[model samples]
Target: MLKEILVHCGHSFCKQCIQKALGAQQQSKTPYSCPMCKLQLGPILELQKNFQLCSIVEAFLASTSKGQQQPGRLSRGRRAEKGVWG
Candidate 1:
């Protein structure tokens, strides 16, 4: 996850994953549960942005290829985004 979103549970997830989860909900006000620990998260809309994790990741990715899941090379195809960096 490049552009990360920090949850109230102190867990970090990618922006896309949270969006997908929220999209699957029946209504906008539905609370999202944490996938890892099942904590009840509030509405995604109230989620705060302006987190600094993006800059850290971008710098790491630029400094080395370590950010990629595949060691020493790029992934052959775009993999699904999860809570953590691939």
Candidate 2:
């Protein structure tokens, strides 16, 4: 998702969605618009990748996966049974 993030008129969208929107625009012969702000994006090729947001998302996901893989953490039910706040 973050790997191919695209930005248009200060809004971000995934690459796949942008591609689909571009295709639709092409068929309609209309310009692409930002999904969030509805601002016109002149050209699909001109769309820029938001590398900073991508990097942050990647890091957050990596940390989340690592946390899930660790076996030391107790489940919510078990913690509650042990008198630990759930």
Candidate 3:
């Protein structure tokens, strides 16, 4: 299951991925940065759970797994994923 978490840079990532990134950056003097945006942030990052996105991803996955059509809103989300923010 993908546990989506929101970082400071307004991008959502898996909690494990973010943890691995933070672990790799441990002991560094430079400030932590968002992997997606490269925005420098504080040493401690505040992670917020993206419940809406989690539901969306879960729904998408479930639909695909069942060979069913994706939800309508997922189409818009796909566009957003391709940098077409709306």
Candidate 2 structure, TM-score to reference:
0.65
Model 2, range 18-68, lDDT digits (tens) per residue? 778778878998877776777787754576787888888888789777765
Model 3 ranges with Cα > 4 A deviation: 69-86
lDDT of 1 at 11: 72
- Global fold similarity of model 3 (TM-score): 0.69
- Between candidates 1 and 3, which one is better according to lDDT? 3
Q: Which candidate is the best by lDDT?
A: 3
Across 1-86, the per-residue lDDT of candidate 3 in tens digits comes to 87999887788889999878877777575678888888976877778899999999998898878867645545556788877665
lDDT for each residue of candidate 1 in 39-85, tens digit (9 for 90 to 100) = 88765445555378777877778765755454655443434333233
* TM-scores for every predicted model: 0.55, 0.65, 0.69
Positional deviation of 24 in candidate 2, in angstroms? Answer: 0.9
User: Among all windows of ten consecutive residues in candidate 3, which has the lowest summed lDDT?
Assistant: 68-77
In every candidate, how many clashes are there? 0, 0, 0
| 65 Cα displacement, candidate 3 (Å) | 2.2
Q: After superposing candidate 2, which stretches have Cα over 4 Å from the reference?
A: 1-4, 68-86
Name the runs in model 1 displaced over 4 angstroms.
27-30, 43-45, 65-86
Tell me the lDDT of candidate 3. Answer: 0.81
